[model samples]
Target: MPQEKPDLRNLAEPVRFKRALTLLLMTLVLPGSAQIAAGSKRAGRWAWRVIFGIVAIIVFLVLLSLVWRSGTINLLVSPKTLRLVQILLILLAIGWAALFVDAYRLGRPLTLERNHRLTASIVDGVLVVLVMSVLIYGSTIVSAQRDFVASVFGNGQKSKADKGRYNVLLLGGDSGADRIGTRPDSITMASVDAETGRTVLIGLPRNMAKIPFPAGTEMAKQFPHGFEWKNCGHDCYLNGVYTWAMGHKQFFPGVKEPGLLATSQAVEGITGMKVNYYVLIDIAGFQHLLDAVGGITVDVGKKVPIGGIGGPIKGYIQPGRNQHLDGYHAMWFARSRAGASDYERMTRQKCVMTAMLNQLSPQKVLTKFQAIASASKEVVQTNIPAGELGTFTDLALDSKKLPVSSFSPVPPLIHTGDPDFALVRTKVAEAISKSEALDKAASDGNGKKSNTPSKAPTKPATSGKPTGSPSKPSTDVDDVASICKA
Candidate 1:
């Protein structure tokens, strides 16, 4: 009984194959375990220490995130932290692959039968590829995220929430070879409560004239009365402010983006709300984003024309329920004004936006993250700092569950040619107050609607033309859901 000392390096064929597979499994489960069992204890100990440290750090971060979400998110998104993560992942891939190789060596693969050797080799190769590929892919995603954060968000001074709310100007820029310069075709300020994420979207018609700039801004000093050009008749509009400011860069010395600054100031003056940040989206590139999420499903209320602003109409998004639109059609759905008034087009744009927000699930986002990230870089440019991304992202998630109210200074409510700035501000305040009251009522378990009525216009204006104003004055809609119906 004492004479039989079994050799691990030269075992029976079946036993040898079994041993080899066991070793590989051990390495797969916990890198270096196989090495410690059969090979060098020193290398295995080092590997184990590294793996344990990584796990401990990850656990600590998870716990920290539970208590300090924004800080953890900011730290993760930081350039240095991302770089460190990228390098660590690469190192882990290489090291873990090495461990698998070492485990194979410890299995004495050469001594096994030819068939057993082949089988062990295939299993070892698969485990290495499986482990290494995931780690490498993770590193790549992290790198992409770092690059995205750097390129999309500015390193601007952080803005605090103004009066328990953050007012962000969303500009849809329309720039083409046919135009002189980029003009903001869509101008909406999304005012969100800092706590509850209650939102009020204040839309200003691109054709709205007589836009005043904030008091201290240079634009205000230049145009003491309001935004106006000497002889630029209908061309001097709200959207043209961007192009105008770009042309007059001398007025905003030391400012990097004078156009955006001018526009934000104009929004502040119009809304009587502080402009905390601005996200300018290129309208043409917006299709890419819609395509990334596998397109969106919206209830198309009317036949939205594809292209007819300066060219012939290409096609139409026919009226339908639960209509699934690709990027191209969705872009046209949001931007088209052909055979439709500006206010009608604005309503359609809000519908598209709402549909996107409601339908874009977290699972879909994760699955299509790479495409979304790439498209977002192309579509969006924002003054919101990288540090505040986590906070705003949280708010956006909260906003999806809440009702979104919208107000536009269009038609009978306020004339685009000669807008009453005072009336516009009052409407803006009323919209915000209504949104807050709704949020409060929801929190208090009161589903009853606000009974307050808006101040109606004494003389409702009417227009005979298709592109002209509607007969009824525009009023604030408490919830966009009712308006965006199929």
Candidate 2:
């Protein structure tokens, strides 16, 4: 008898559709499984290997994070690692999309009924689009991070802190295309304890006169007495020092950032603390960054003006508790200087910083990764080296466990116009001592304390005293988070 003819009947239309759907879904849930079921076994095997490799990396990173968080953070922020990860993400996306197409081919939809063929094609197309979209989006985020790292950091070795504390000069300034030079409108020194991450913010008024530079710096030599520019009628304010230094770059010959260096030295001289580094934030672009992270919530102490300094007054941010503000409103809230006293503005700015620190948790950062990464590149410029970021990052995390207290040398504590450097340094030391004592108490009590540390002094002290009384201390220091509770 003739050999039995092989059956050539096509699978039922419904059966073909169901198989196509299964293969498409399988490829999505477990890339390459569909190929193993119906296509080239070799391709399927390769796909599995890729999947396993990715899974292994994820597990390794997770383990590293749990065991050595600081190391993990450093590695993640490393420029070389970031570049490598960006390339790998793109390759993974391309490979995943190809796998979806292969799964469709293995299904052999061409031999199925017309309707089933159309349905399979649609499913295959959708899977490709979805996988590509997600992978490409992730790759973009990685690329942004890499660019940000490269732009902001140098290769300088991490500097050691002085007296177990790192004093960083934080400047908030506005630089417009129409404007001449950047003015550091808001000046604050962040004194962070190297061991405990306890912090104290020392605020200085912008218009404070007789600002002195470091002992050996060029600015100090030129002024000798202080930052007194003769052209400004022998009265140069703190903020104007930047503009003066910029104009008189010859005084700081060969220096790349004369203004910044001079300002850093001025802050050092004023606070009587060694300045580790400086961070200058552009207030004009500040709103964009704030909006990117879904705006910040702050306790509005009073009505803050929106505009009216240069142009017409727009409106006012009404006083309220826990007011959620968008980028435009948040910038105005921090910067509006029309009606509010400079000291009040400084206090409000401190509150803004406190609110941001508490609210911009890890979860929020991850969720708004793209917007934040983009905005960071535009808004922030700092001398903080890439090598030192991990140290500061670890310290910042530690700082969150305790309240952030601030000291403003605006009024009765020390006259800003003619600040007594010795007195300022004494008060700063006293503040640090208080913080250390509080930490000691917490440790002694095994994380249980009957009374939290008081934010301010309960007794007043005479001027020039090393340790002010409780009432006087209140003027200089405050638990910003509690004061600006939302």
Candidate 3:
């Protein structure tokens, strides 16, 4: 028996090299082809079937999107689907790894020359790594989405549009361990047309006092005329609504998010728009999110402070056009109020949002998906129903082509301290009308040029100075796409 031990060196030169090369090339072109060439043809046929099925499904989805965009997006973003996707990816990783091992087995590397066996092992190792890496990354995105969807949205019914519009209240809070409660420093209402997705941003000041609440809400009943903390003297600012409401949580009864609910009521009263949902984002935590998308590009109008609040001045963002900003600098770009008015800060924030929306292309999202998903989970908290997420996603994609116009109820237009509710409503209505009219005009223009697709939205010019008039400090409305154009 010992004498019968054979050596691969006995194989003919042609048989050794040709057979190994054929197997390696087969697997490279078709993952299971090596098995068909040497092992069970049935197994290889099944692998081919799976591969074809995956491609077919992807093609079907692409076609579905053209016909029923919202339905496709909804199905894609659904948390349940994401969970199933995670499971499928894990299974795929295992299955593909097995096919690779089987391909190497069919190569009969053990019976080849030492150099040929070494080459086979290296190729197999590389294939395994590439396959596993992609699967793991895909799994990470699904997991992140699952956790985020569970944490942020409820399993509530989809909300209906109000008068052909969906209004969402966006609140930015700068809370730290040292802080007693959250103070919503920035409040903005996004009124989006139900069909066209055209949006009008209404910025509200944090220092606004006597904010009116809805007629029958808890806060309305408590403050009757408006949100006034006369007992706390002059500290009853609009931003303090959350902190004040948190102290009186008993009044909210069974409300899960008492602070957010209270602020939504105040925002509804102030904007004269019924908010269907609210998103409370932590300003400090937003930096990580910016970094995840490889930072956002912004047209820095002025030299903005980096880190000056509750600490020494760190640095400044120099004025520039199309400046690429990281997490730390972008946070300051949106928030820094040092040597700048709050109105100016809001304008910068709006520009930042617009820049992010424009620059965050689909390719970038796919490549940095894991980081974006992880960062989003930490910063954003919302009451938007999970079922409606797909609809909003589709709307956002459609809205990208349309211009975004902004209106801030500041200074000469309407005093924040004693804002005229009637006048504010009128201005908001007019802004909405103007935005719709512009969209209609753009559509008509595009139709006239039927042979060509619509061009990118134009941006407004940028000046380092405040967006408002220097002499009178009046509210200014402009296209954000133009304002943040690179």
Candidate 4:
């Protein structure tokens, strides 16, 4: 009451609130998962506070912007997404705090600045985050992707009978050429059972020979008068088959050719499931997907050299041991081979893919939801409708143990003229057979089996498994190429 000259803080109020709001928004919107819990705790830390704060804040802001659409709110997310959102938020808060410190240093009176600076910064950050969270979660309430497969897949309702087991085709592509005839480097089929919550991932090497497409004999036919039969590694390259047959007809998503259709048909015939869901993630798309997932943790089984492959992947990298990698590095790990054998590459691909999946969960992806979704759209072409996709996710949410197992089928069971190709084809077919039977068994048991099947089965912890070269040791087999400098 000593008649303090009418505290002219009104004009400053918006400025104060502005700073706070900006910080808050940055905090919530950021994509780092750490931001959610340690937000307050991180604020109390000492060394390199500015770095942590800014990094977190920037991450949160990016994530927040990603979550909330321009005009929509879609915050009702599962746990993993939520956790990711929170982590991102914390990162944003730290970022905001750093900026706040800078603002205070450039400005005036210590008492006022100190009194309001931190509070203003964090509150503002939280408010912005809250608003963004709501928007991001709300917009996708009826995600379009959910619609494409909804009619057939059901809305996470219905009895076990409706859920059924599934055979999903996962294609990893290196479209060095146009999308038209680019072959898939890696092919994986996943068998998932909702009731049992079991999942198995099997790998198909690129050079597999003697692949029988679902089109019966029709799949092997050449395109035109002078066009070569689509025979690539075996009688025909898988990619060529797609362009030759499916591209013109447009039967599947990103199916540019009948290759996918034929492959699907073959798998369906083998598994007896409609082969309901197909996800084609090209190399670029796969890279983006891994990037969106914030990189993955993988293990290097042995000393490996890279950059020897004839294409863009020619270089030698000696990874020290089990390590972590971001999107680009992971891609390299999946595709590199200075001294790696083909079988080694197969193992590496599976390891990288599994590591990528392990990184996603409801609680971990909330903040980065939009980026993930965007990345998914660009990188992946899936046949499962959006609604069905949601159901699949929801089912994943419910169960822990899925019924499945995976292994390459390309063992050199028999010697052949084209040794490597023969082994690859054999393994791919064998893997497909195993996956199909396991998934069918799960589906059949959904109604007849336990009311609640656990989550998908976990691949045994082979984090330290070696990436070994495979050559047919059969009496009649021949090595394709001499071992590279390992």
Tell me the tens digit of each residue's lDDT in model 1 across 1-486: 577646865556788889889999999999989988988999999999998999999999899988876778888888789999999999999999999999998888888889989989999999999999999999988888889888898788899999889999999999889998889998888898887776777878888887888888888887777887663345678898888889889878898789899999888888899999999999999999999988877767778888997899999988777688889988998899898888887777776766776678778887787788899999999989998987887777677666567788887878888988899899888888877766556553365333222222221111110111121224575466556655
User: Candidate 2, residues 1-486: lDDT per residue as tens digits?
Assistant: 898633324567677678878988999999889888877778889989989998998899889978776678889989898889888888988988888888887677777888778878988898899988898888888888878888878875576899888988989987777677999898988988786687888878897888777778888888788866564454389888788788888888778888898898888888778889899999999998999889877667677888867767799988766578899998998788887677877777776776676677778888898788789888898888987877788777777666777787767777877788788778877777776666666563455332233333332111111110011223456666544532
lDDT of 4 by residue, 257-329 (tens): 4666666654443333356566677775576777876776654545555445564544444454446566776
| Angstrom error at residue 5, model 1 | 8.1
* Reference-based TM-score of each model: 0.90, 0.87, 0.88, 0.54
The positional error of residue 140 in candidate 1, measured at the CA in angstroms, is: 0.9
Ranking the candidates on lDDT from highest down gives: 1, 2, 3, 4
Q: Estimate every model's Cα lDDT from 0 to 1.
A: 0.81, 0.77, 0.76, 0.48
| C-alpha lDDT (0 to 100) for residue 176 of candidate 1 | 89
Residue runs of model 3 more than 4 Å from their true location after superposition: 1-12, 231-233, 307-311, 442-474, 482-486
Candidate 2 has its poorest 10 consecutive residues by lDDT at 462-471
Answer with 1 or 3, whichever has the higher TM-score.
1
Question: Candidate 2: where is the Cα deviation over 4 Å?
Answer: 1-13, 176-179, 229-235, 308-312, 444-474
Best by lDDT: 1
